[model samples]
Target: MDFMGFFTKKSSKDTAKERLQLILIHDRATVSPELLDNIKEEIMSVISKYVEIDKDELEITMTTSDEEEGNSPALVANIPIKKMLKRR
Candidate 1:
C-alpha cells in the first residue's frame, strides 16, 4: 500500500465542514444576510429604546430549509445583555 493512499478517502469532519459551508452560504443568500443584519440592528435599536444590550456581542443568523424539512426560512439573532451593577 502507498503512503499517499491513506489520505485518499475524505474524512467525515471535512465532509461536515463542506456541508456546513454550503448550507450557510445558501441560507444566508436565500434569506439575505444584509436584510437579516438590518433586521437585527432594528430590533436592537427598538430594544435599546427600552433597555440596554451589548451590540458587539450580538449574533444574527438566517436559515433556509427544503419543504421536506417542514420549516420556512427563518431569522435567528442572539443579543447578550450586560449585567447591572448591584448596590453594596
Candidate 2:
C-alpha cells in the first residue's frame, strides 16, 4: 500500500481554488475561450511560415503584467521553435 498517495491526494478545496483562479483570469481578460483558441491558431499559422515549430509544446494564455503604473493583463505565448525555414 502506498501511504504517500493518501497524503498527496488533491482535496476538494484545492480543486475549487484552481477553478476560481481560472475564472478570475478569464473574467479579467474579457476573452471567450473559443476566441482565444482562434487567436492561437492564427498566430501559429503566421509563425509557421517563418520557422518550424513544435506544435505539441505550444502554449498561449492571458496573464497579468506589471507596468510602470499598474497591473495590466497581457497575452503570453510560449512557442517552441524547431528550426528556421530558409526563404526561397
The best candidate by lDDT is 2
Q: What lDDT tens digits, residue by residue, belong to model 1 across residues 1-88?
A: 3989657987899779867965776565675656666888789887776556898999776555558867566565677877543443
- Residue 28, model 2: Cα distance from true site in angstroms: 1.2
Model 1 lDDT, residue 85, Cα: 38
Over 4 Å off, model 1: 1-29, 64-69, 83-88
Please give the RMSD of candidate 2 to the true structure: 7.0
Q: Global lDDT of each model?
A: 0.70, 0.87
Q: Model 2, residue 5: displacement in angstroms?
A: 25
Write down the TM-score of every candidate.
Answer: 0.53, 0.72
What is candidate 2's CA lDDT for residue 72? 75
